[model samples]
Target chain A: MPRTRIPVVAGWFTEDTAEEGFRLLGTRCSGCRSVHFPREDDHCRNPGCPGGELEEVALSKRGTVWSCTDGRYRPPPPYVSDPAVPWVPYTLVAVELAAERMVVLGQAAPGVGVGDLPVGSVVEVVPGVLEEDPAADTVHTTWHWRPVAVEALS
Target chain B: MSGDVAVLGAGMHPWGKWGRSFVSYGRAAARAALDDAGIGWPEVGSVVGAQTVRGGYPGYVAGATFARALGWQGARVTSVYAACASGAQAINTARAQILAGMADVVLVVGADAAPKGFFAPAGGDRPDDPDWLRFRVLGATNPAYFGLYARRRMALYGDSPDDFALVKVKNAAAGALNAYARYRTPVTAEEVAASAVVADPLRLLDICATSDGAAALVLCGMDFARRRGVADPVRIRAVSTVTPTFPRTVLDLPDIGTDSAVAVEPSPESFRASIARSAYEEAGIGPEDLSLAEVYDLSTALELEWYEDIGLCGPGEGAKLVREGVTALGGRIPVNASGGLASFGEAVPAQAIAQVCELTWQLRGQAGDRQVPGARVGITANQGLFGHGSAVVAVR
Candidate 1:
């Protein structure tokens, strides 16, 4: 039997199995065109514009790396890592989306260390498992930033 | 000209991991400030406190807490929390009260007893809280963000680890002369280099630790100061507790993404720079008038970033300023002469107040060994989590 796949947070990404479907979900304001990640469905955040309908939209998958780092120690809980296993350090990358003109932070793809990417390097969003519960046979899913090849930048 | 609030006195309980309650530290600092001002608790017409999350119920209502601890006398009370900028907001609130004629003399205090290791979000399964979501989803610790800034600086400004180490050396040297600093021993570049890595591209020494500490100040109108035989006291010329402008492009703490700039153009000045600009405009003085500065140095690289944010230099020129020792003690526009968070660690609410306390000492020429000679103007710059931007300009 296939393990259950659960998003760490719901409605943050695309679910369909279409090619190029892996995208971080964000909300765009109908009146002002302001975009918000983690999908703001309730109200438009633009203070100047009166108010507008927020429409869920897929964010650009590729962007240049604004900055990146890795956690060297186990983070305090609420972050679901098993204490029984040795902590595997994970790299975090902040990617700047050109269309939105915002920098989005996410974990780097598994096995991608700080040395693998540099500031201004292009990176794309990919679906990845955030954590796995062995007893429950469930996998918590999340979005990751993967560095694109140097040749792919041009 | 914007009115000024005279800083009659400033005090602090030395910053350290002392196993004590927040009330004790706050009361001690408050008493010290009152004593230094030659005033008693009965003379204080109002009290403002910088709230801390670590302390239970009393921490939230810190003004009343400090009042009750200092023996309540029906003083008007206010408590404020702007994350790390709580102290600045408290000062701003007290200044507003005094300037509004609501109080003749107001006491401002901020204190915190922090937990060990990484500062985590308050416990719960609240999905709506952005702070909790970031930690749970990404495990992005504070140092991780610091590392990102450090790496970006290196890439953009050709700053090396050696340059970052020099910041620690400079701050530690200043801290060594500060009797109130927790880590009074001067550190070398080798010591900073040998420290364990807590985040990639950033070592343990590069980041500040969590500490239990407190700070307080006695603020009064210029009239009150003169009536009390105190003339020409250190005056708080500006207390900037401004919020971020819309379409904030920077990635600040407790947030997963920046505000989208599609709807509106981003500000020409970053949020951090805006904090200082507002303070400078209000103070009627430019960065050139500053004799010294006390900026929040959560990380060595962040201090360099502040050089540009506070208009000490152009963008990306921060590393060059540090390399030239221009921000070191006895140098041009010395930064963090109080030893900074690097030596004091973080006491959350107290940290910003501590910065002002250091300014008070320097401006009064009473800073003992860490004194900036003939210091007249000083500025304290700090940014808290969320949209809070804090900076205070003081002059003798």
Candidate 2:
């Protein structure tokens, strides 16, 4: 049985790309101009601020690497990691979005080894797989951030 | 509006993996509280439940679920979900009802049946969820954040792992005296060092466990308490349920990233600090007036953070206070006098209520061995996932 592997949330990004590139979508208040990811359908969360209609805003596609670290151990269940295939250390990065004014986290792109990127480096949004559970027969999908491959400017 | 509600009674079902339903735990706690208050269940005018997350669903609603288990008697019911701070919010909700004269007597309950091991986000292909993103992408479990905080403390305040281990040593010894705690055996620095490292810089004993537990409180208006002949009860003078102010810079739980300080300068007082500050302001008391405190010691190092955040000491003075035996029982303003999460593990919805339950017992001088001498005023502080912060001030 072929099951459609999909992002559990709706309207959170531009669209899933074959190259796995998509801009995460959020909402911005027209009045105070506060941004919300997963899009706050309600009023602005900027406390006691004047009411403003929320508009869907595609966030900046790239951001500076804020911080990065990786887990050397398996997290508890509900985060679908394969118990069989030995744990592979993966890098995690926090990206700073200028427009959204918040830091967003995602997995580093494949082959982006530890120590390759440092804080303040620029990275861009790219798609990634969450997990492939052989027992339940599903391939969970997610997003990642890859280094922009900028030329070294002396 | 300094006139506050009275905490007539408080109770808890001991925390551990008993493999029973959360409803049973809640009902037992509720009954114990009613017995302590000398009140009948039918006279309770309202009930508020602190919700839990179970099997990827919202945790069984403590109000309706436990009410159902006890046979609902037409009490107004409310359920609150705020991750760890749910219980305190439930008590806050009940206090509001009592103060409003909407209900003279209200029952507040929170309970949880937690899974064994590191807590994780719900199951799904949820890329947009920050919690799931942290787990799937980084495999950053709760311990990783604890490790980050511990390491940051070490770097900033020169807190050693041995200093962090002392928290467990103190708390476990206190837990050994507490019948309601999960791990009652006193721990040693050697044992903490020998324990498996879940995250770099934080050992297994450094982190609190996830266990099944329940807590409940009986609250009533001042007039109602007097009428019930419960004079001079432990009064809940203030409940500070404040949100972080603008430019919250610290990375909190269930969030992938932090608010960038590029636009505006971060506040001088962090959100965690503000939670206790608001409580002090509402109670018209200062940290100096407190005889004991119940802080969220989710990790041994995190306890040290609370020492600073709660203003028991300065930012870098937490480890020093612990090393000086200033936070243990018989110490000045003894912290985590209920043994805290270090002893009890975490029961999510039940914890904040449990924190107050400890304060209530201590204020009444009924906490057997873990009691602070002449305990008069106590403060309980906790933070929940997704920007929820809570603290309660109780005075005899």
What do the candidate models score in CA lDDT, each in turn?
0.91, 0.82
Of candidate 2 chain A, the 10-residue stretch with the lowest lDDT total is: A12-21
What DockQ do the predictions score, one after another? 0.83, 0.27
CA deviation > 4 Å runs, candidate 1: A16-19, A151-154
**lDDT tens digits, residue span B1-396, model 2:** 346899988888999999998888999999989888988999999999999767433365557887888797999999988888899999999998888889989999988888888888877677667777666555778877776667657756778899999999999988899999998999999999999877667788999999999999999988888998888999999999998986676667777656544335568998999999999999999999999999999999999999999899988999999999999888987998888899999999999999999999998989998888898888999998888989999999
- Residue A9's lDDT within candidate 1 is 93
In each prediction, how many residue pairs overlap at the backbone (N, C-alpha, C within less than 3 A)? 0, 2
TM-score of chain B of 2: 0.98
- The worst-scoring run of ten residues by lDDT in candidate 2 chain B lies at B256-265
Docking quality band of candidate 1, CAPRI definitions: high
The alpha-carbon RMSD over the true interface for every model, in angstroms, is 0.8, 3.8
- In angstroms, the error of model 1 at A53 is 1.1
